[model samples]
Target: MNQQNVRNFSIIAHIDHGKSTLADKLILKTGALEQRVFKDQYLDNMDLERERGITIKAQTVRLPYRSQKGDAYTFNMIDTPGHVDFSYEVSRSLAACEGVLLLIDASQGIQAQTIANVNLAMAGNLTIIPVINKVDLPSADPDMVREQLEDILQIDSTEAILASAKQGIGVEEIMEAIVERIPPPEGDPDQPLKALLFDAWYDLYKGVMILVRVVDGHLKEGMTIQMMATGHTFEVEELGAFTPVPKRIDRLSAGEVGFVIAGIKKLDETKIGDTVTEFKNNCDKPLPGYKDVKPMVFSGLYPIDGDQYENLRDALKKLRLNDASFTYEPETSAALGFGFRCGFLGLLHMEIVRERLEREYNVDLLTTAPTVVFHLKPEHGDMVVIDNPSNLKKQDRTDTILEPYLRGTIIVPDEYVGVVMNLARDRRGIQLKMEYLTPKTVMLQYALPFSEIVFDFFDHLKSSTKGYASFDYEFLDFRASDLVKLDILFNGETVDALSMIVHRDKAYYRGRELVKKLKEQIPRQMFEVAIQASIGGKVIARESVKALRKNVLAKCYGGDITRKRKLLEKQKAGKKRMKQIGKVEIPQEAFLAVLRTDVK
Candidate 1:
């Protein structure tokens, strides 16, 4: 393919912004996928993606189009996920494209990820073409959304493309915009090959397949290539682009996006953001903006059965092939036995990992409450990393505990501003800025601790705003806070899995509610089970599960008062002895049920 004829761009939008429908229309117009095999959500190959109607992984396809002006162009359209949890995916996708179609829903107007991704695309030097999608809906106000685009992104309303992607409206105009507005790739194919490994996934039969963008040179089969980051080398076994699915091609030249099979045996060999180049002809400098993904939330994943621990480990290895954002290590808890301490980008990322494990791998798992990384400095020693909250018990009171904070943004309707402000205040959010984009829409910015919103922030935000709010956030820094470890005790034994790091002011209230919830979950036993919330061996709150009792005097109903008293005394004495030896059998359900104990 001619380099001048190739146009590299990606579609960026918020979740449920009609991106998949738009892609289907363009692909149909360009004949990328055949009509017989075409189904809804064509690019969303995974079952979860199709079920959720969202794109989780980034996808690319090559389309051949002949414009009305009699010019043929090979358009490389990269599709990216629209969720904030996958914002990093958007950044990586932007790095591979020369331009982006910033799609906005004509009814929803500007959202959090819309602003975030626009800034990211601009930072990556990608051209932005504002697109107003879903214009055919009765509630779609194209003029209002166009004004939002202008007010927030400074986009010219006159240049905005209005179309309904579902009904194949303005597809020709979109194609024309690509040919006229977007720039072609610029590089020398004759030079040494340098490709960006934007994504990679393991194949059961073919080994690890890497998705790459040919930045400088050509990639062909049988070529020996080296990974710039890990210094691993292997010969290319297969090479091709997703002609929607993998179609074996002879070569992928400069500016083309495709996959390279280099006989990689393990998923770890191919790192996302690593540069792939020829072994003999190497590039001078590695690409800029190459950084490892930092997981913002941490949790524990233990199998329901002990034997499935190995299976859990293997499943994670397979899942991590494409998802380098999640990291895990072997960890053990006294209450849950053996498990892995896993790190994730956020709660949604963690939830998806758990769901995929149960559904795809058919392995049941026990997950702990999600937590963020904490920095604890002892009074006499160096700083310690606390990924799980259970480790906080060892810290001294004189030590400094620094908690992670984030710069958060929320865009919602003006009517819900008061509710949102109150929610933020309760979560320790400090208002940074508030602006009115339109008469009905308002945007709020706040600085909040990671621990505050990592669990239920999105859920509450949706409820308060009546599903009209969009939120996005990034790490700011770590600061010292008045934090303490709140421990949950069952039968006088501390359960490490249920321990939490809480602020001192809210400690007593949270402790009370937690113990009450635990009391409701634990089953009644022969011996009374006492559940307590404690700090440094001091009990702050307590709840009790009453023991099951049987009447010991029923057989002596006709006996005298002395006989009845003797029976009662003997039964009481036997109960005391049983309490010393009887053990409480806690089912796996009790541990998992604690997460659902929402006090409010």
Candidate 2:
């Protein structure tokens, strides 16, 4: 195949804008999939992605297409994750292509991610062919969507195509547009090998399988490869490209996308952003590595059964092999026992990882409330980065504390603007600006503390907006904050996993609400269990769960109300002695029952 006949592109879009579906139609039209096996979202074969109707990972398929002009072309289309959590991942996928099909839902119009990704594509200097997907739906307004696209992106809307990916309309037109509009990858195949490793996964039989885009030179089977990032060399056991499935080839040349199989034992060694080339004939300088995806949130994952701690460790290890954005370290909580402190890209990333562990690894995990990493500087010592709240147990009062902040952009229906403003203010968000996208839709910008959004901001945003809002954010910088640690105690014993760092103004009320929720979740023990929320050793709120023996008024009636009150007073006085000797058995679920909240 000639390099001139090759076209590399990626499908960029907001969530559920028909990226995977369009990819499916293109693959089928190209005859990459036989009619007997064609299916929607065939590239999103994972059970989780199929069930959720979203693409969680980046995937690529090689298609051999013949243009209407009768010229054969080799098309490599990369499918990228659509959520904000994986925006950086999407960038890596886009980096593999010379251009992209900017897919948008015609009915939903342009979204937050659509705006962000358009900027990203411009930054990369990639050609963008706007695509209006879901045109088959009755609600689709191609003309309106086109106007919005031109207004927001300043792109000529006349070039945008209207199509229904699900109904297989405009498949040929899009394919032809890709070949005619997108330029072929530019690089000399004779140069020293330099392939950008964009994605990877762990394989039980083959070890690490790295997905790469060959920008220059060639990679073939049984060759020694060097990872520029890790400075490690490996003997390639296999080399191939995806025809929606791995297909062995003699070699992957420049302007091609494929996989390099080697005996990679540790995933960190084959980092996604690294450049892979021949060990002996390596290029003098590796390709510019990608901007690593920094984790925006942190949490603790403790096993429901203490004995499964090792299993949980193995599960995380496996999950990280495929997901480069996740990071973790060994951490311990007095209340939850042995567990690991994990970092995630966002709340959705945290949820997906938790779900995967439970469904795929078959291990029940109790995740502590999510938090953003905090910077703590002592009065006379080096600064420290803390992710777990329990680490603040020994911090100094005079030390300066800094919290991460983010610039959040939200697009919402105009009707929900009031509720959104309230939510933003409650979360310590400062309005930066507001603008109307359409008469029925508006966009807002805010400077919000990352800690506030890390926990469950998206959930609340959707809740307040009636699920008619889309949000995206970028890290601004860390700034000084008046923050304090809120601790929860059961029977006067501190529960480390239940501790969290919050702003001073919110501590008292948040503490009060926390203990109340815990009181409902924590089961009564052999003796009366007293739950307290405190900060700096001062208890702010308290709740008590009486023991079985305290229920002496089981036969209470309206006529016996006075007697019931007397018994309750007696039980309360007697609880003083019982509380001193009682140990509250907080159930596993109690450790995370109310973690759904954005704060402690």
Worst 10 residues of 1 by lDDT: 591-600
lDDT of 1: 0.87
- The 0-to-1 C-alpha lDDT of every candidate, in the order given, reads 0.87, 0.86
| Clash totals, every prediction | 0, 0
Stretches of candidate 2 above 4 Å error? 394-397, 550-583, 596-600
Model 1: per-residue lDDT, tens digit, 188-275?
Answer: 8998898899888878788889899998999998999999989999999888888776789989999999988878997677778888
Inter-residue clash pairs, candidate 1: none
Over 454-535, each residue of candidate 2 has an lDDT whose tens digit, in order, gives 6668888887777889998999999999999988888788888888898999888778777777777887775777789888
* Per-prediction CA RMSD (Å): 2.5, 4.1
